[model samples]
Target: MSRKFKKVVEYTFLILLACIFIFPLIWMVASSMKPEANIPVDMGSIQSLLPSIVPSEWFQTYQELFSRFDVFQYIFNSVTYAIVVTLGSIVVNAMAGYAFSKFDFIGKKVLFGLLIALLIVPAETLIITQFTVAHDLGILNTRLAVILPMIANMFFIYLFRNFFKAIPDEIIESVKLDGANYWTIFWKIILPMSKPAIATVGTLSFILSWNDYLWPLMVLTDSEKFPLQVAITNINTTPPVYTNQVMAILTISTIPLIIVYIVAQKYLLQGLGGSGTGIK
Candidate 1:
């Protein structure tokens, strides 16, 4: 085959793959704009990917959702919690990573080894222990219960450590010679250069916190404190379940995550590709 034909085939294959992955999102947004009765009728056909032509039903599900349910409160709670945890995790994990990469403290090797070991342990196994600790701290049913447990992740620490390791030692030494302390070097010098890593961690952290459902459900009994994911379940289980409303809520919940990924796409790619140097 000619080179031009091969290129054409490759592009065609890639477009098909992209469409396969994006179909669900299109269907969801389309369904959300449709009436409940129209959803099932359009399913399994190309029409499923298109919104209702009726102007009245276009936003009917959203209107009902806002009027009957405190969806804004749930969205607010989730966004607040995700932001707090994402920012906190980035700072704490970055600092820990800096220490591990630059400092020569005792037991640093052992501690870092333990941190790496933790990556193999399934997070589900720790839920019971986390619950116990949260109960002991008397933070159950509170925002703190959710935020605190997720703010210091081992994988993010490891990612930051590897990213920091890629920085030259001469940079640290030169900064120190100019009377800059570790904090100055870290905040002003290191962090500014580590945008890719920061974006990677922040994006992942935000998504994790936003999608988290079980822990919030277990800890928070009050509907008022529930996050969007848990609140969606409540909407589903409530009597007179409306499929359109459920689709609308899911569509709403997914938008933030899509926006985050789009904004961070460049940095996320760089960070995942170049952040590591064999875990030294």
Candidate 2:
């Protein structure tokens, strides 16, 4: 076949793949527009992508969601958690990463090595241990339970360390010569130059913490304390004919993530591109 034909085929395949990936989102939007009784009768499986034959009660699903739960409160809780986690993770991980990158100390290599090793350890393996600690600490039902663990993550630390490593030693040395302490160099010089990396880490952390369902389910028994995903779980357990409400909830849940990604796209792309692209 001609190269032109091959190019056309490749484009067609990619377009097909994208459509397949986005169909669920499209269906969710369609369902969110649907009336309560008209919502698709999905049995907790992968929901149907096909829109209902007739669009009906657009307001009731949202109405029911509002009545049963203070969605504003849920949104506030999610936003607060996401913001707190993102900021705390950045501060903790960036400092750790900077030290790991720029400082030479005894056992530094060993410590970094341990973090890399822990990366392979599934979080599920530690959930029970974490639960025990949380229960013992009396923070099980509070926002602290969710926000505390996220303050330090191996992956974000690694990203920060690597990003800091890519910065020239001369820059740090020069900053030090200009009467800057380690904290000053970090806050003023290193961090300003590392916006893309920080944004990347912050965005990912926000999304992960926002969408987190299992841990929240385990820790927060109070409906009032629920995050967006946890709120959706409660909505999921509602009576059988809740198609529209489920769709509405899912739609609502997806919007924050979408907005965040859109706002951070530039930084996210730069951070990802820089990740493994650096020369030692």
Per-candidate local distance difference test = 0.88, 0.81
Model 2, residue 259: distance off in Å is 1.4
Task: List ranges where model 1 is wrong by over 4 Å.
Answer: 1-20, 41-46, 269-280
lDDT of 2 by residue, 83-167 (tens): 9998998999999999999999999978889988998777777989999999999999998997898678888888888899999
| lDDT (Cα, tens digit) per residue for candidate 1, span 1-280 | 6999999999999999999999988988898898889988988888889999887889988998888899999999999999999999899999999998889999998988888898777777688998999999999999999899888888788889889999999998998999999999999999998988888898878877998888999999999999999999999999889888988999989899889878877656554532234431
Judging by lDDT against the true structure, name the best candidate: 1
- Which regions in candidate 2 have their CA more than 4 angstroms from the true location? 1-19, 40-57, 266-280
TM-score, structure 2 vs. true: 0.82
lDDT of 2 at 168: 98
Report the error of model 1 at residue 6, Å: 11
Say which candidate scores most in TM-score: 1
